[model samples]
Target chain A: MPTLPSLRASGGDGADPGRDEVASLTFESVTKRFDDVVAVDALDLEIHDGEFMVLLGPSGCGKTTALRMIAGLEEITEGRLYIGDRVVNDVDPARRDVSMVFQSYALYPHMTVRRNIESPLLVRKYRVDGDGAPPRKLTKAERAARVDEAARVLGLTELLDRKPAALSGGQRQRVALARAFVGRPQAYLMDEPLSNLDAKLRAATRLELVDLHRRVQTTVVYVTHDQVEAMTMADRIAIMSAGRLQQVGTPQEVYDRPANLFVAQFIGTPPMNTLTGTVTTDGGTGPAVDVGHGRVPLPPGLTTRLEEGRPVVVGVRPEHLALSDEGPLEQKVRAVEWLGHECLVFGAIGDSPLVVRQTGLARLEPGGTARLVVDPAHVHVFDPETTERLP
Target chain B: MTAEAVTSPAADRSPEVPRSRRRWLRRYSPREVLLALALLAPSIAVFVVFFYRPFLNLLNWGRFESRRNGAYFEDVGLAQYREALGSDDFREGLWHSVQFVLYTVPAGLVLGVLLAVAAHRRLRGIKVFQAIFSSTLASSTAVTSVIFFYLFNPVVGLIEANWLNDPDMAMVAVSISSIWQNMGLSFVIVLAGLQAVPDEVMEAALLDGYGAVRRLVRITLPLISPVLLFLLVVLVIFGLQAFAQIDIITKGGPVSATETLVFKINRLNRPDNIGIGAVYSIGLFLVTLVVTALQFAILERRVHYAR
Candidate 1:
């Protein structure tokens, strides 16, 4: 083992002698408190190896704090956290073998892109999983080759000599990614890395990040308030609000079956429109919710789980609401937004506003009424008392 | 101008904009430029009367060499400039000034940065320490020199050191006072610079696995190099012009070993050697100008200005 002034991960000669085995990150009953306020409360999650897990929430929902805890930037007030099999509750960030990309890109402005990418390898030891082949420092040539490969991977080869101040926002973002992956650390933690990019570039970079994750195949715990980024890039999305984890599942699963009202409203574009109602037995035809201007049927399977004439809040997504001439619900159209391929018809039932998505042009006008229907399969029922999902 | 003049242009675009209003948008109107000049008139007048006038007089007087202890004079043109500058007295005085700068500048900068970095954290009552560090700025240079003079006194003094009485150590003793006196300004400026560095950059470096020392050397120092360079230029200028400490502490004593260029110039206030004093004064100005210019030329390129 050479002295630790130089280290090379994934050097060309010894590249992938064995595949870089990644580590799963787990948090058990984790809690974080600041002064008097609880920032993250009893967070329990297991982000598996090679998984692209996104922590999705609104701002100040403890998403960034959770990611920082994984990076060892913040202390967990209670509970055990694990990277792989090690309980890294007291481990230093550097020895924990995880890397992070900050929202600001946090590139060393004075160093060239090459040096920025090569910095972690120079300082951190190679393969620090605390087992298998004692950790050793890398040689200089190996470090250089690893930097070259990272630069090539992130399309930063031509910009290696330039400082961060010289790069555009997107280019700086790539430099940040290159720096994070160049060391091949066990896991990568990102906190809203694309929030600074323009909308068009953000969309493009979302795909680029997903592709990078596929190639790198390392565990990623990404934190963001933007659902679009989470939906498009995450293998799983963990939704949080007000310092507590609401639910965690595959993106589609969370989108289709939110565990609570917060997850339902926070996971979709235009969000889920929830109207309060009372469940009725409907002459034993099974339960239905009388949602003010219309009575929408509940899933017949929910009859055994539901009570008669019980108070409930029914949720339906905008895309689930279809415009039908014979539909029972009468929605007074307030506005219509034509989005080329489809249109969003924003209308209301009495006082509750509802958004309905219709294919092609919505030949509807403001101040007119829209007849809309919601399928029972797409309707989500929640317990009005606790705001939790009703089975 | 009308209240909505700026905002109403788009609303009334079809109406032709007056030429003067257009010029104001481009940068400034002629009337505004005149007002700016008028505002600067007082400061310009003061500089001309008190600073530039005396400076020009000194330059002109450098052309003549005094004869017969100011009873007579001889116009030697550039000859006096050459001869007075080349004289051993002038050389020795300039050497002493340079020595004083070398003793004070680096030590002051280092001590300032150390103290600033120490007090820049978020510990409870840290503001008290910051106040203590910057308290030296409250004292006049004479007060600081007098305090040190008594502290280093051989009899009835703090440590009883004889450096002030020894010719070789006299400049070092005086520089000690100067460095202490200049430290407050440096600490305040450097602390401001350190505070301006975004906390996120340091956090990023931490996640990048840089230890504390490497983070300071590689990230912190380079990011604040511009501010450090500014501190250097200011300290260098103050060091070159140093006089009050010398006058109060050692009075250019110990066989005049501590007679810096400024001290010597003041000593030549008599009618006899004012010509030589003018020449040394001009020499000090040129040296300051060149040193500052050299520092900016060499170091400005390395400074990283955050975008």
Candidate 2:
């Protein structure tokens, strides 16, 4: 495989050097509806130029639908979408200048890798005069050069002659990437392109995708159900659930300050332990939430927001819980999972299920009782009815 | 280790000879073998009696020439085969068969693909259109031929065209019936192939800057090539064996322009020309075999079976 330098050189004068500058994408109150069902509801998002933004959600959460809208594959029912500064709501998908890698990779099974990569260029009608002029035909050499450059960038030079059926899943995925890259469109919309690969290959390809993003410097709107992919690869992560945007932030921001109960539970493994509790100032050791197990103290900032006897759902991540001999909460242990570096303790506080992440050689029998303490600052309080965080 | 050591010698010494015999007996047990033979007897008897016996009898009959309406017979051997193949009537019949195949096969394929592509979409009332496309499947070959025969009849046809009268156009008229009758089967098969294509692949093509026509040509067609090839084989066989259409429409008339091999063979199966009829039947079999082999050799190379 010829490296990135050769690819850049072969791009020729026809390649726009200013392509990186014009790749910002924005959705202004975009809503997509299918008959009576809403797939995406008033999604307003801004993906910066050259940013690798990931739409992270569970299946049927409308992340793929949102990405399809950007790719011009799905129509926006109610709002305007802009690629750079131009509204692209009415543009045909072929005219939108965006490429997508589907979850199945969707490599053309009949064509060799070279032909698959060159397909976009082969179909591209050349501009005779200017951007909107009458389209001319591309030369065979031009198509070949573009294909070669894309294949080289993705290290697919040797397998260019092989059909997609002959290639492994990861190689086929890279061919899909190369095909999308050959066009150098304004942005790339990826709908879980790595979901087909096995675990190890998915991880390796995920890293390669990040590297490819760095080299290409194009805005990418990637959708996936995996939070780990979002956490590791995204410059900004947009979390959605039930066709609504829950939060949009850096991975750490969404992890630390989830906007609602959904985000707090969805973003982490073993999820956050939630308990129904009443805020009572009568405990007199600062403000405390009287969960059924005992009263756990609330931080001052959260205390200011709570009224007396206000019912709130308190959320604490598994990592935030500590097993202390003299703690405020008692949990009956149900199971223990030792995961090399850390141990996950599954138990219950009264009737509410609780999971605790204890690091380094912590062992607790399944039938035993353990005292657990949650730091006040780490406790998240949400309104029970709306499931929205307080303050 | 101790159990294996104790059992190893006993296993090796006790069963080595009997094991071979037992294995043979197990593979070919009498009752099981009898059951298998009994199960296969019906199909084997049918093949030998209806298929192979007739073919062998045809070969034997091709060697003997009948005279005076089978009142006398003489063995002529391979000369009869040569004369049957070299006869101008047989050549004309074979040429007519080839012409019929050329007319119907390509028309069947193109129309099948067109109908399948048109109907394989997501639209309101598409099922109704699909049912309309496949409605001809209910009509048998004889019924379709009769319908087309009347439809193309010069005196009372809907269009009153001279299609069935002209020597050059009679075969075309007969082919039209076959193509119409085949439309339903071809449409259904091709539709199945089109449906088997993953929706994501089409969406990917759209995202990759392909328009509707390009997507169909580059993605959908190649993916369904196997189905098309299967349809091709079926259409080719149907074209070669065509009889009812020609029988009903032309009856080998209009200068014998539409007299296919099967029609000639049927005509020659009298008491006076049974030898020639058997020879023509064998020749037609070889021709069909060669045509099918050529089609498979050429078309199967281009087919891409989905993994």
Q: Write the per-residue lDDT of candidate 2 for residues B119-170, one digit (tens) a residue.
A: 9988999999999999888888888888888999888787567888899889
- Score chain A of each prediction against the true chain A by TM-score and list the results: 0.93, 0.93
DockQ of each: 0.27, 0.25
Angstrom error at residue B217, model 2:
2.7
Which one wins on TM-score?
2
Top candidate, metric DockQ: 1
Alpha-carbon lDDT of model 1: 0.85
Residue A293, model 1: Cα distance from true site in angstroms: 2.1
Instruction: Give the clashing residue pairs of candidate 2, or none.
Output: none
